[model samples]
Target chain A: DVKVTQSSRYLVKRTGEKVFLECVQDMDHENMFWYRQDPGLGLRLIYFSYDVKMKEKGDIPEGYSVSREKKERFSLILESASTNQTSMYLCASRSGQVRGNYGYTFGSGTRLTVV
Target chain B: AQTVTQSQPEMSVQEAETVTLSCTYDTSENNYYLFWYKQPPSRQMILVIRQEAYKQQNATENRFSVNFQKAAKSFSLKISDSQLGDTAMYFCAFMKHEGKGTYKYIFGTGTRLKVLA
Candidate 1:
């Protein structure tokens, strides 16, 4: 079974705090992604890494950064957490696939709240 | 670039019934992939079914099937004997065959489904 694990399930932080959300995949997938989901907005990609230390900006990348130092772990960082940053964050990984196996296995999302 | 659309913002099915969720996409590329993903309350998104644009036949997985209309760029999911566990947010996604290299997904605004016990 493929397992994608997030560092936290629920997090609360001050408005000025720097936050880190970690994701680790045991399946050795080559592609990983971070997405923030809002009520009616569905899931919007923040960033993605196709390989270790290689990253690409998605549709929304402002106020966020990512790290992929190792092949199994990807991290999403909020430079300065804000009230607007409160939402469900999801991490996903996919194997070396071009089309048919494009299905991404996702982690149980982390719901973060900024005060 | 490709875009996915889910026309139904919300849907409901009584337990043990059948339901269909609509999805449409716009892409100029001929060979691509379409997928249906279900995000339950637990916030874990799971792949429900997949459809390849080049394939003429629809795809199915037990109770979950898809009606793939390639010409119209339409991909719809049909759930048979819908159970309470089937209630979730269903997202339709599209990914282009970017050679034999990498492929990225473009997802739709999901449809929220409710199942009555």
Candidate 2:
């Protein structure tokens, strides 16, 4: 079965620390995304990459950045971790081809805690 | 701008009973996609069902079905014969394709459903 694997299931970071959340997909999907899931806000997109070395800022990309050096790997970076940045981080991948299963395949998710 | 709304924050149903989760969206685009995702206590979100905007028929998957009213911009999920394992957070989502391989995905706040035994 195809899968999107998130490197860490949980992480704790100190304020001002640089944090990295890694996601790797074996499905060879062309589109990868990072989202922050909070209590009241379902899932807010942080960044998405449609191709290697390409990225676009989503609705909530204020304190985050992303890198897609290869087709199967996408990483989210927290420039300066803050308490407010603590939330469940999700990684998803999708096929660029429009013919089948257009819905995203999500990873297990990482719950990040910024202290 | 596109937005999805799940007015019901929490719902409950007895085992073997039926329940429905409500979802509404606002959009001007004629063609798009709608989806219902389930996130269990394990925290892994999975696709429960999907509906194509142009199709008049609602989508169904086993015991999970959808009530898609395109004119009303509403999409609701119905769980039949609710099972204890069905307890999870359900999210309604809207997807709009913007050409050049760019797409916008928006999700509702989500409804937490509990199936009592």
Candidate 3:
């Protein structure tokens, strides 16, 4: 079966430390996304990539950056981790279903804690 | 911009019973998609069901179905014969059909559903 996998299921980082959350999908999907889910705020998008070496900012991109050097792997980098960034970070990928409709397969989320 | 809303933050249902989770959205775009995703205690996001805006017929997937009222801008999920595994946080989402090749998933806060045995 096709899968979206996260390198880590949980992580704890110190404040001011750089953190990396990695996600890889085997479906060869063209779209990959990173979102941070918080209570009451829902899943806010941090960044997304539709092609390798290409990326775009989403609704919430502050304190975060992304790299898509390869098609299967998408990495989220927290340059300087802060307590406010502690939350469940989810990664998802979707292939082209059709012209107008698409669905996503999400990886098991990584719950990040910044102390 | 698209916005999704799940007014009910929490809900409960007895085993083997049926329950519906409510979702509403606001968007100017006439075409779009709506989805119901379940996040279990394991924190794995699973797609429960989906609805296409242009389709008048509500979608059904096994015991999980949807009540899609396009004119009402409401998409609710109904789980029949609720099972213990059905208990999770249900999220509603919206993605507008902008032809500019912009694809984004906008999500609702979520509804926590508990299935009691």
Best by DockQ: 2
lDDT of 2 by residue, A1-98 (tens): 99999999999999999999999999889999999999988999999999899999999999999999999999999999999999999999999886
User: Cα deviation of B29 in candidate 3 (Å)?
Assistant: 1.5
lDDT of each: 0.92, 0.95, 0.91
Could you give candidate 1's per-residue lDDT for residues A79-108 as a string of tens digits? 999999999999999987553578899999
**What digit string (tens of lDDT, one per residue) describes model 3 on residues B44-97?**
898888888888999999999999988889999999999999989999999875
Regions of model 1 farther than 4 Å from truth: A97-99
* Model number with the top TM-score: 2
Q: lDDT score, residue A101, model 2?
A: 66
Q: Per-residue lDDT of A58-99 in model 3, one digit per residue for the tens?
A: 988999999999999999999999999999999999885456
Off by over 4 Å in 2: none
Which scores better on DockQ, 1 or 2?
2
lDDT of 3: 0.91
DockQ for candidate 1, C-alpha atoms: 0.82
Over B52-106, each residue of candidate 1 has an lDDT whose tens digit, in order, gives 8889989999999999988888999999999999999999988885654756678
